[model samples]
Target chain A: MNAIDHPLVTAYLDAVARETAELPAERRAELLADLREHVEASDARDDDQVREVLTGLGEPRTVAASALSEETPAGHIHPAPVAPGRAKLTVILLGCSGPLLLASSVVGTIALIAGLALLWGAPRWETRHKVIGTATAVAVPVLVFVGALLGAASRIGPIELLLLLAFSLGVPAVGATVLLRAVRR
Target chain B: MNEAGGRVPSQLRKGLLEYCVLALLRDEPKYGVELVAELSAVSVMTTSQGTIYPLLSRLRREGLVDTELRDSPSGPPRRYYTLTAVGLASLTEFARAWPLFRDAVDHFLTDPQGDPA
Candidate 1:
C-alpha cells in the first residue's frame, strides 16, 4: 500500500516531478507529495487501476503546462497578436476623430470617444502614442471652444471662425497621427 | 474537432475546478484521495484526477487552503486539507457570482435575439 513498494507509482511521481522541474521548489515538493499520497492510498491492486490512475493524471507535459498557466498571466497562456488590419483601422479612426468634430458635434463626439477607446485598447500602440492620442483628444476640443468664444466676442468674420476651427483641430490631429505612426509596433 | 480539441471543456474545468475543491472542503477537512474521489465521481469536472495535485499545490500557495499531516488508521500518515478563512470568503464570493453568470450564459444561449426579457 506504500508508494515506496510500488515501482510504477514511484516512476509516475518521478515523471511528474521532472516535468515540473522549473516550478518553485516548494510547489514542486507539494505536488510530488500530493501525488505520492494519492497513489499510495488508492485501492488499485490490479495493473488496470494503476494504469487508469496514471492516465487520469494525464501526460507529464500537459500537467506541467496546466501548472505553468496557473503561475503566469492568462495572457501568457495565449499570446494573441493584434492583426495589422486592426492596427490600421485604429490609426484611421484616431485621425478621423478630429475632422469628424467639425462635421457634426454629436456624431463627432461619439467618433472621438470610440477612437480614443480604440487607441487605448490597441496593444500595438506604445504608451507614448496612447498618451498623445488621449491628450490630443482632450486638448483639441477645449482649444476650439476657447477660440470660437474669443472670435465671437470680437465679432470676427465667418472666415476667421472657420480658420480658427481648422487651426485648433488640425494641429493636434496631424501631430497625433504622426506620433501614432512613429510609435506603432 | 475544432483547432483545440476538447479545449473548451478543459478551459472551463481549469477555471472552475479550484472553486470545486474549495467547496468540497466547506464541511470538513479531507485528504487528497478523498477529494480526488469526490471530484472524479462528478466526472464532468475533471478529465485526469491526478492533475488535481498541482491545483491543490496552488491553493496552498495562494493561502486558500492549509494542510496538516496526521496518523492514519490503515496506512501512512495522511495530509488533510482544510479551508482557510480566506478560502471560505472566496467560496462565498464565488457562490454569489456563479448564479448570475450561469443565468446570463443560459439567457444568451436560449435567446437568439439577445432580448433582455
Candidate 2:
C-alpha cells in the first residue's frame, strides 16, 4: 500500500518500533498496523496533527506497558515501582559512605598491625606488608570511583553497579589477607 | 404521570461485556476497530481503540481467540480475530447461562411479590 511513504506515518511507526522491539514481532506488527490505520483515517493531514495523535496516545513507556506480559522476563526483571527510587538512594548513600568506611577500616587495621609489630620488634616484612595493605585498602575506593566513572561515561547498565560494589569491597579484603599472612609468618 | 419510566433497569443490561463480545465474533472474524464500533453501537459500551486492543490481546493470549495479520486494501495490515474452538465452546456456555441469569435477575427486580419461591 506504499504506507511508509508518508514521512509522519513512517516516523510514528519507527518510534513505535523502537519502543516496542522487545515485544514479539507479531504483536509489534499488530500495534503498528493499528496505529497506522488511525493516522491514515484522521482528517488532520499534517505532521503536527499526526504528532498530536501520537502524544494523545501517551508516552512510549505507557504504550509499551499495555503490551508487556504480566510475567517478568529473566535477567531483566522489571523492578517494582519503588525499586528505582530505592536504588538511587542506595547508590547515593554508598557513594558517600563507601570511601569513608574503607579509609577508616584500613587505617584501623594498619594501626593495629603496626602496634603489634612495634611491640614485637618485627622484621622489615611486617612493616612493608602493613604499608602495602594500608595503601591497597585506600586504593580500593579510587578503583571503584574509576570504574563508576567509566560506567557513567559509557552509559553502562545497572549491572555495572554490581561490578563496582564487588571491586570496592574485594580489593580491601585482599589487602587485609596480605597483612594477616605477614603477621602469621 | 411521567412520560418516561424511572432509571433504566441495571439488571436488564449489566456485565454482559464478555458475552456480547463473544456473540459478535461468533459469526465471523473481526478486528479491533470493527469490534469496538459494533459494541458501541449496540450498547453504552464506549471504548477507545487502545482499550479494545489490549482486551483482544488478552483474549488471544488466553486461547479464547486467534489473530492473524492480513494486508488491508485501504491502509496498513489488519489484525483479524477469529474465534477459536475453545472460544466457541465458551460462547455456547455463556449463551445458555446468560438467558437464565438475566431472567432470574429480571424476576427479582420486576416481580418482587410475584414469586417467593
Candidate 3:
C-alpha cells in the first residue's frame, strides 16, 4: 500500500509535516514525501520496525533543528572571504619575514614585527605552532647577532660571517615552512 | 550511543551527519528509508529517522543532491536521491580528511602525557 494504514505512523508524519511548516514549500513537501515513503516501505505488520523507524527519526523539532543549521557536506560552512584571505596573508608574511631579515634591519624589523602580529592574530594556526614560529623567528636572529658580535671581537674569518648568515636565515625559514604546513593541515 | 542521554553525540552528529548522507549516496541513489536505515545503523549518528529528511532537503538546496520521483514496486511513487557531482566531490574531500583528522585526535588522546605545548 502507498499510504501507511497504521494510525501511529500517520500521526507521526502529520506531526513532522506540521512542525516543519516553516521550511520552504518544496522542502516541506519533499520531507513529508520521504517520511511517508519510509513508513510505507517498512514491514508495517512488525511493530518493532515501526518503533525503531520512528525512534530513529526522532522528534520533529530536532529534525528541523539539524537542517536549519547551515552545515555543508564537507562538514563546515563556506568560510568567510576575509578569513581565508587573512590566513593566506599570515602565511605569506611568515614566509617572507626571514628573507627580509637579510636586508636592512629597519625593513627586516618591520616585516618581522608585522609577521609576528599577523601570525598571532590569525585564527587558522594553532596556538602551539604560532608560539613556536614566533619564538624561533625572534630568537634565531637575535642569537645569531650576539654570536656574530662575540666572534667579531675575537677577529674571526669570513666563513664565520657566512655561518652567522646561514643560522640566522635557516632557522626562521624552516620554522615558517613547518608552520605553513601545520596551519594548512 | 545516546544511551547515556548526553547531548554531545547529537551536537557532534550535527557536523558529521550530512557527510554520512553523501557517503551513503556515493555508492548509488537511495530512497529516504534506505538512507535513514543505513545512517541509523550507527546509533550515534541519529536518534530519529525524521531528522535525515531536513538534512536531505538542505543538501538539495545546496546543490549537492537532486531528487527524482520514481514508481516503487510496492507503493506510490518514491523520491530517490542522487548525488550531484558536487556531492561526490564533497564526499571525496571528506573521505580524504577524516582519516587524518581521526589520527590527529587519536594521537592527542593516546599521548596525553606528550609535550604540553
Candidate 4:
C-alpha cells in the first residue's frame, strides 16, 4: 500500500525512519509495516482523526527511546564514561604531549639526516625509501602542531604533560584492564 | 463510571491495562484510534497512541499478538492487531487470576481491622 495516501501512517513511518536511520533497512521496513497495520485497524474515519491519534503517541524521539530501551541487542557500544578527574587529565595530556611528540620526532629526524649528509659530504643524499620515510618522518611534527593547539587551549604545562602521558597510556593499557576484569566478576 | 463507589485512580487500574487491551482485540483486529475509544468507554484511563504503541510493540515481541498492514479506502494504511494463540492463552490465564487478585485487594481495603473474617 502506498504510504502517501495515508498521511497519518506515512507520517508515523517517516518519524520512525528518521529516528531509526542507523537500523538495517529490512528491520526498518518491518517496523513500518507493523505500524501501518495498527493504523488500518483503528476506527479513524478520516485523516484528521488519524493525525490526532498519532499526535498523542508522543514525539518520534520518545517513541524511538522507548523502543530502544525495551530491546537493545547484545554487543551494542555504550558511550565510554568519562569521570571528571579522568576527563580533565585527558584534556591536559592530549594538549601537551600531542605537540611535543610531533615536534621532537620531526626535529630528531632532520637532525639525523643532516648528520648523515655531513658524514657523506654529499650535496644530495637520496635513499630508496626516502619518500615513504619522509612521509612517516613528518607525522610527528603534524601531531605536535595539533597537540600544541590543544595544549595551549587547555593551558597545560610540561609537568602536566608528563603526568598526562603517564595516565593516558597507562590508565587505558593497565588500569582499565585491571578495573574491567574486576568488574566482570 | 460510578458502578463502584468513586473514580478509580489510574495507578490502581494500571495492572489491568494489558488484560483489557488483549481482551478487546480478541474479538476483532482494532487499530490505535479505535482501541483508545474502546478503552476510554469502560474506564477513565484514557489510551493514547504514545501509550498504546509501545504496549503493542512489546506484545508483538512477546508473541502475544501479531500485526498486518492493509490499504485503506480514503486514508493512510491501517495496522490491524490480532490475538495469537499465545495471546489467547494469556488472556484466559489473566481472566482466571484477575478476579481472585481483585477480591483479595477488595477484601483488604474494606475489612475494618485488616481481617477477611
- lDDT by residue (tens digit), candidate 2, B1-76: 1221122422222245556777889999987667766766753443223434545665777688998888887656
Candidate 3: regions farther than 4 A off: A1-3, A46-52, A70-185, B115-117
Question: Which of 1 and 3 is ahead in TM-score?
Answer: 1
Candidate 4: C-alpha RMSD to true structure equals 16.0
lDDT of 1 by residue, A1-185 (tens): 54345677778778887888877687778777777677667767777788777777777777777776666645554323346676566666666666677677777678778777877786666677778777766665676588677766377788976876776467656756665565453
Ranking by lDDT: 1, 3, 2, 4
After superposition, candidate 4 runs with Cα above 4 Å error: A1-55, A59-65, A72-185, B1-14, B40-43, B112-114
Model 4 CA lDDT for position B63: 91
Model 1 CA deviation exceeding 4 Å by range? A1-4, A73-185, B1-5
TM-score of chain A of each: 0.49, 0.33, 0.52, 0.35
| TM-score of candidate 1 against the unseen true structure | 0.59
Name the lDDT value of residue A175 in candidate 2.
Answer: 59
Clashing pairs in 2: none
Write one digit per residue (lDDT tens) for candidate 4, span A39-105: 5555566777777656655566755654554344346544333344533333233323323443575
Task: Compute DockQ for each candidate against the true complex.
Answer: 0.39, 0.12, 0.43, 0.26
Clash count of each predicted structure? 1, 0, 6, 17
User: Could you give the interface RMSD of candidate 4 in angstroms?
Assistant: 3.2
- Residue-level lDDT for A59 in candidate 2: 55
Q: Write the per-residue lDDT of candidate 3 for residues A95-140, one digit (tens) a residue.
A: 6665576666777778788888988776667778888888778865
Model 3 agreement with the true structure over B55-82: per-residue lDDT tens digits: 8887888899999988888667888899
i-RMS, each model, one decimal: 1.5, 3.7, 2.3, 3.2
True-vs-predicted CA distance for residue A143, candidate 3, Å: 76
